[model samples]
Target: QDNAVPKQASGCVSCHSADGNPLVEGVPILSGQRSDYLEAALKAYREGRRTGGPADVMRFYTKELSDEDIKEISEWFAQN
Candidate 1:
């Protein structure tokens, strides 16, 4: 919520593609996951309740995102 405009839709879509890097070693797939689960995971990662590898990398990605961003991302995946 740093008052910055949300990143472009293309940015979000690029990495979350079905054929994207979701399963890359330690990366988590948001595609097809429940929204609640996605939110919880985001919260855990952002809060340090989760740790290690891409969890940490993903935590960094989630940390700076606004709650709205999380919700939008979750919804986007659910629809796809």
Candidate 2:
């Protein structure tokens, strides 16, 4: 398996931390999350279907993510 960090994770770790703990207050931990759930959430954000706190931020980030990008990112965080 390729264990190197995913390129897409750079922006995520700024707030969500590489270890899964969020560095910022109100940011949810991404580590140990379910990959399927994460993928769905990311897709929702990309589609502008998810709303609430940080929704705009998430939408911005996720908008350019392809399905494979979402899968890789979600799996990376889930396994961490």
Alpha-carbon runs more than 4 Å astray in model 1: 1-23
Q: Write the per-residue lDDT of candidate 1 for residues 1-80, one digit (tens) a residue.
A: 12222353234444554433553444556556787887777778778888886667667677777778777766666545
Cα-based lDDT for every prediction: 0.61, 0.90
Task: Give me the candidate number with maximum lDDT.
Answer: 2
Off by over 4 Å in 2: none
- Per-prediction TM-score to the true structure, in the order listed: 0.67, 0.91
Cα lDDT over the full model 2? 0.90
lDDT (10s digit) by residue, model 2, range 1-80:
33767999788988898885699999899888999999999999999998877998999999989999999999999998
Highest-TM-score candidate: 2
The 10-residue segment of model 1 with minimum total lDDT is 1-10
Q: State candidate 1's TM-score.
A: 0.67
